[model samples]
Target: MTLTAILPTLRASLPEPVDPALWPAHTETTTDDVLVAAVSMVRLAELTGTPCVHTAEQAPPRYRPRSWMPRDVSVAVASVLRVRRPRTGVVLLELDAVLPPFAVLDQVRLIGRVSTAAPTRTSVVTPYDGTDGEPFHRLPAPLPADVREGDLLCFPCVSAIRHRDVVEPVRAEVSR
Candidate 1:
């Protein structure tokens, strides 16, 4: 079925609105392997009705020891106000606020197969420190998917903690 036909079902499956203030802070890590971090951030804004910020930090090469002094930078902050699937394999995401140094909107065209499977569970992990791991929440199942973008992708809003390692899961429903 087309995305339009399945939108209502997807919307109905969303968990009851949680108080944004009560929601824990979330952070997402970006790398060449996952270029869709922004998409997840946008989804987080949509779910929480809050602005999400994209930041970057300079760290030593992979597998290297943590730098005693790291520099963290803010790339952008924005919120996803609207999402439209004008046609198959294309999506237009609208944003409310976009900080300097980045475009305000994103148009994604799916060039590969998309997944539609339901997620087993959903949660957010905070920045890790030597002491305790970040807080985590097990979200509802059947998470929404952006079929137009070719995957069942879900982005949860998170608060960025110290410049430590933070890994957030953006799971696809299934492999095409």
Candidate 2:
């Protein structure tokens, strides 16, 4: 089956405006592969919502291949806000915020309701290089402001931490 068959008129396709750099080329797939991924994505979409689920499925297949990181996955806390012209409001979450780990970045899927009546463009925080072992991350341009603060944003990491090296823990010693 072709991609058109598997996608079957996706409601929320990937964001087309972000720099080409944010997303990698989709892994070459056979009809069977697309079907499998599509099926999995459908289930995921049902749980999350149409937009997020569609974005997850469109991500390069290689990004989500089953894998584990040496260090545990952690997230940084920050409120979503509106940025300047290029940047829109998105959750500026840092993964492995304190420590660096090893693994590939996973795809991010976002879900939100219409905050504004008009259609607005959107963007999200994606790693600079998803293939790299470093933890440094960056945000894409022109994220949609349509989503309110409470909306959920789910997507893969822009990149992953390395699994080979040991991450040093940051322990705060308190003296009484």
Count of backbone collisions within predicted model 2: 23
Query: Relative to the unseen true structure, what is the C-alpha lDDT of residue 70 in candidate 1, on a scale of 0 to 100?
Result: 41
For all candidates in order, the CA lDDT equals 0.31, 0.31
- Alpha carbon RMSD to native, model 1: 17.7
Tens digit of per-residue lDDT, candidate 2, span 1-176 = 22332342332442212222233233222211122223343334346432321222223333454662322221111223333334543334433222223212232223332121222334333345445654434433222334454444333323432321212244588999
The global Cα lDDT (0 to 1) of model 1 is 0.31
lDDT of 1 by residue, 1-176 (tens): 33422543442333223222212223223211112223444343345443344454433333546545444433233333455555643334443332222221121111122233332222322223355643432333322334322222222223233212222234468968
Over 4 Å off, model 2: 1-109, 112-138, 158-173
Clashes of each: 3, 23
lDDT of 2: 0.31
Model 1 scores a TM of: 0.28
Locate the minimum summed-lDDT window of 10 residues in model 1.
102-111
lDDT of model 2 at residue 77?
18
